[model samples]
Target: MRRLLQKVLDKSQKAPTQDAPGSTASEITPQVMDGVGTGSEAVDNTQAVGTNPIKISSVQRLGFQNASNSCSHRDLGFTGKIAGKWYAVFGDTLWCAPGVKDPAQDLPGFHGMVRDSVSLLTNDPLTVVDLNLNNDSPVKHQLQFVPFNPAWGETNMYGFGGTSLCETDARSGTGAVYYLVNANDAGLIGAGVAKVVVKSGTPTVTQRYDGTKGHWWDAKTTARYGDVAAYRDERSEYIYLLGHPPSTITGWLAASYVYMARVRATDAFDLTKYQYWWGRQQGWKTKVLNVFTPETAVMWGTGQGQISWNAYYGCYVFVHLAIGGGTVHLRTAPAPAGPWSGDVQVYTAAPIDGGLVYAGVAHPYLDASGKTLVVSFTNNNHIEVIKVAFTK
Candidate 1:
């Protein structure tokens, strides 16, 4: 227990000790707000969503629901440490209706294991966030649950392992590996990052940095897309990560674009070595604010997103919750930093027939045949997995 507590504290600081000498910590001022509160054991939102609960299990590779509704899955959550190893994405937001329940009431909200299928993990609140009294007030001071809602839920936190582990490259599906996951400060709006060894077959927590928000690649910034998807671009030998910077629009935190950032894959854990895709015609530029003004060539299918290299297509394929949220779209790029193609249709769900649907996950590992690609998403009642075949 002491080991776990210590690990959480270590990862909580966003300021990594490995940062390049003299690097300044991004002042986490306005972008992130703060909140902390109580939680009840998971509630049954299934009744509110009007769907009867079903059993949860690994779904088949293509377009079918995983029978895990009884577990109260957070549909749009993500996974961690990809170099093809089996790891869990530890933080997840609760599945909530548009206006039905206050998500903040989801104290031990958002926690799970994101693999080929979604698995309900633990909901132990670990990271802690002490926020400025008026999160929006220019005069700042830390307060308890100051800003009520926690952002970055749908896009949960996790990243992939690099070559350092188990001979894994950017695209390997399984390996003897290390998985570093950022579990959010449970019950808090603005929380620090707790770097837990989520899954490499066994889970452990090595460190934490609790002063900033819950993502290791990010500090407390108001608008950001986190739960970073990282991979080592064997071509460039530099590790590339597709990140989303989220903003609150019309009172909901939704995202529309995907950002690019890179560092030597060996330097994956060092925040200082990383560079951002500024989207200038000139491409990547190093900046300290860690901010980007123009987005990459592609826009997000849904605020929640995913990008993976599909060998069958011979390009990086991005799968997302299509604009309306009932379908998933696929776009391809020759390079990780892309001149991306517009999305080609991939999978469509029952929303066309009238029911709520969102959260799409791509499982390239399932495409053993190389001619087929796999994708998954969930409705309030069940998690669906789909397989896509390429013709010509």
Candidate 2:
């Protein structure tokens, strides 16, 4: 898969000066999709973002150019905006001390100091400023708000593997950002939540709901939510979450099923208050519902994604990667729990270092001009953003 995506990436980066024999200009020339100029021309890879076909105008890689010192931790660049500034949380960071050229070559896994990290996004979400770069020695980057206390035999390479940062509760200028925790490269054991307080301007994890049960944090269960995406609806005052079972669950990748659950924004920290959508017939229920069969699943093969309202499309848009495929996909729904539109291909991510593209998310707030959208994805090393416009 990595080789295949790399070839596509190589092809898209090339500029053919002349057409091949017997080929017309249309056949040999690169046609830009969505009419958005990328400075460098890209082959017309027709794809859709929701119902409208889109043109990718530009693609920019954010943060340190070298992998030895990335701005954010490895991958999972889902975003949140506080005080009009963008912030992103990353999982399992590896950084070399200053002057190190290659961490992989000099020290293995950056001397094995891997942990979840956070960063501040500036310059219109094109630059990453590592929040923990100034911390004391031994701390590579800004660490997780809540410290991980794993049981015996567990690795420390995981925390907030998949995270979603939503709005602060109106009651307080603070809120909780939920994520998948208790995981390693082997499997994700559970999901967790931490109270986040933005102090003087920086977001900090002050506390955690360690006692939550059921869907919140269960060491025995693998069907934890909040690992995909989370959003707080301003109009309804509900925190909607999209989730999928971890790979430890049988047939998870092959039969990927996404489930939707929601809690009142104010009650997001309480797991008991959550309710799951069981279609229009069964309605929302407290009891855990069965995974939607393939015929009934709203969206499937979604490993990671983000959901945000798109005023341009007049619906909620979901940008996610197809599990095991390097292709990014977009879907739309009238509401959070929906009768969703069919999947539409938007971008094909090129794999790096044997890692397929993951964590594709749309930053709706970054695009002021409603005509275009800003989206981001990563290969677990650095964040990449692209500007796209949808055709009417």
Which predicted model would earn the best TM-score? 2
lDDT of 1 by residue, 224-248 (tens): 3233344545456575555445332
lDDT (0 to 1) per candidate: 0.38, 0.57
TM-scores, all candidates, are 0.54, 0.74
Q: What lDDT does model 2 reach?
A: 0.57
- Best by lDDT, which number? 2
Clashes of 1: 43
Cα displacement (angstroms), candidate 2, residue 374, comes to 1.6
TM value for model 2: 0.74
